[model samples]
Each structure stands twice: as structure tokens, then as C-alpha cells.
Target: MNIFKYINEAWESLLSNKMRTILTMLGIIIGVASVISMLALGEGASDSITNSIESMGTNTIYVFRDSSVTNSKTLTLSDT
Candidate 1:
């Protein structure tokens, strides 16, 4: 029922198994670092794509010819 007793027992256990404690701590650190790096990489990639789109301006037009559609017409300079 005493909080200090539980804390003392946990501390003793951690000290008794030094290797296990160290390995567990290392695993947690590595897992957390990997998650943080992955999130940062995803955020960076998103920012890069967003910047590229913004740099192209809102009036940018993309033209593509569809080979599957025979009725598709090619864009001419006069169309713009």
C-alpha cells in the first residue's frame, strides 16, 4: 500500500538485472528515434511537393493526349 515500498522494489529489480534494463532502454530509444525520423521525412517530402505546386502558380495547365480515345484532339497554341 506504500508508494515508497513499490518504488524501492522496482529500483532494486532494475539494479539486479542491469543488462536487461539497459537493453530495454536501448530498444525504447531506438524505436522512438525511428518513429521521429520517419515522421520528419514524411513532413519534409510533403513540404517539398507543396512548394513545387505553389511555385508553378495557380494558373498552370497540364495537357495530355489520350491514346485510348480516338476523338481526343491535340492542343494548339491558338487554344490558349
Candidate 2:
């Protein structure tokens, strides 16, 4: 209810438990960093997929004759 009391209590607690506060902050920082890295990786994967789709050959019917055919279905930029 009181802003001054809240501030005073927070400051006192922080000052008294310096190492604990810093450790908690570090955990939060690591979580945020991992979340950012995952998002960036996801975006990169999506962009690559988009580029691949855009460069697909037109009127080329993909024949999935065999699943073991590695070079059969994949169309690279060179094929575009």
C-alpha cells in the first residue's frame, strides 16, 4: 500500500542478500538468452524453407518412387 515502505524493504533485502539476488538475476538472463536463441534458430529455419519453396522448378512433377533416393526429390538452387 505504501510505495516508500516497499522501496525500503526491497532495498534492504537486496543489500542483505547480494549473492542470492545476483544468482537469481543470472538464471533469468540465461532463460531469456536461450529463448532468444531458439526464436532466432526457428526464424532461420523458416527463411531457408521459404527460399527453397520459391526456387522450386515449375511444371516439374515430383516422383516419389523411392524413399531411399536422397538426390531424387531434393531440388537445390542450382536446379532452379
Candidate 3:
């Protein structure tokens, strides 16, 4: 069979079922849009997290004191 003939047949079939064609196209569009939106949301969240971390500075350290270890010398800003 010729490629052009097959293309013509497929096009005719799609035209015959207008509703089906529209529905199929709509489904494809929705699926692609949802995927794009999800990707954008994930990227935005990742950027926000990265920015938050970077803003805090890389050399920053968190020190949590335990009540069990009571020392006379308390943590001061100068120590950090």
C-alpha cells in the first residue's frame, strides 16, 4: 500500500468520528498540560528550597545544647 493512501485513509477515519477525535485530542492536551504543570511545580519547590539553604549561608552550623550537660560556659555569638 502507498504511504499517501494510508495517510488519506487514516485522515478520513478520524474525520468520520468527529466526537472521538475531539475527545482523543482533548485527553492528549490535558495529559501534556498536567505533566508540564507538575514539572513546573516541582522545579519551583526545588528552587525555593535551594534558595532557602543558600540564604542561610554554607558555613552556618546549628548547635543544640542538651539539658543533661550543664556547663558553666554558655554558648555565645562570638563562639560561632
Candidate 4:
């Protein structure tokens, strides 16, 4: 029931099943690596988008004309 007894039993079990231990360790390593890679990729993509938006001047404005409304006024350079 002591911690040392539990540790000894676990060690013995692992040693007795070498293949299972190796496979379990390999799975854990691969899972951790995959998670890290995905997080890094997501962060890189987010930073890229933020940098692109920031590089565009703050005064920049985008206007989209609605084709569904025939009565909408068209934007021209003189309107600025």
C-alpha cells in the first residue's frame, strides 16, 4: 500500500511487458508532438493575418455595392 510498493509493482509490470510499454511510450510521444505542431501552426497563421491587417493603413476603408438594390448610389472618387 506504500508508494514504494506501488512504484516497484509498476516497474515490474512495465518490464514484463516490454512491447506494450514501448508502444504506449511511443503513442504518448507522437500525441504530444502532434499537438505542439498544430498549436505552432495555428499561432503562425494568426500572427501572419494580424501583421497583414496592421500593415494596411488605419484610414483605409472598404465599401461594397449591393447588386440587389437598384436604387443604391454608386461610389466614385469624387465622393471621397
Best by lDDT: 4
lDDT per residue (tens digit) for residues 1-80 in model 3: 99999999999999999999999999999999999999999999999999999999989987777778767568787986
Per-candidate Cα lDDT values, in order, are 0.94, 0.89, 0.94, 0.95
Assess every candidate by TM-score.
Answer: 0.79, 0.71, 0.76, 0.77
How do the residues 1-80 of candidate 4 rate in per-residue lDDT, one tens digit apiece?
A: 89999999999999999999999999999999999999999999999999999998799987788889978787788997
- Between candidates 2 and 4, name the one with more favorable TM-score: 4
Q: Please list the Cα RMSD from the true structure of every candidate, rounded to 1 decimal place.
A: 2.3, 7.4, 3.6, 2.7
| lDDT of model 1 at position 77 | 91
lDDT-sorted candidate list, best first:
4, 1, 3, 2
Cα error, residue 6 of model 4, in Å, equals 0.4
Clashes found in each candidate (C-alpha, N, C closer than 3 A): 0, 0, 0, 0
lDDT of 1 by residue, 6-62 (tens): 999999999999999999999999999999999999999999999999999889987
Using TM-score as the measure, the top candidate is 1
Query: In terms of TM-score, which candidate is stronger, 1 or 3?
Result: 1
Candidate 2 residue-wise lDDT at 78: 96
RMSD of 3: 3.6
Preferred candidate (TM-score higher): 2 or 3: 3
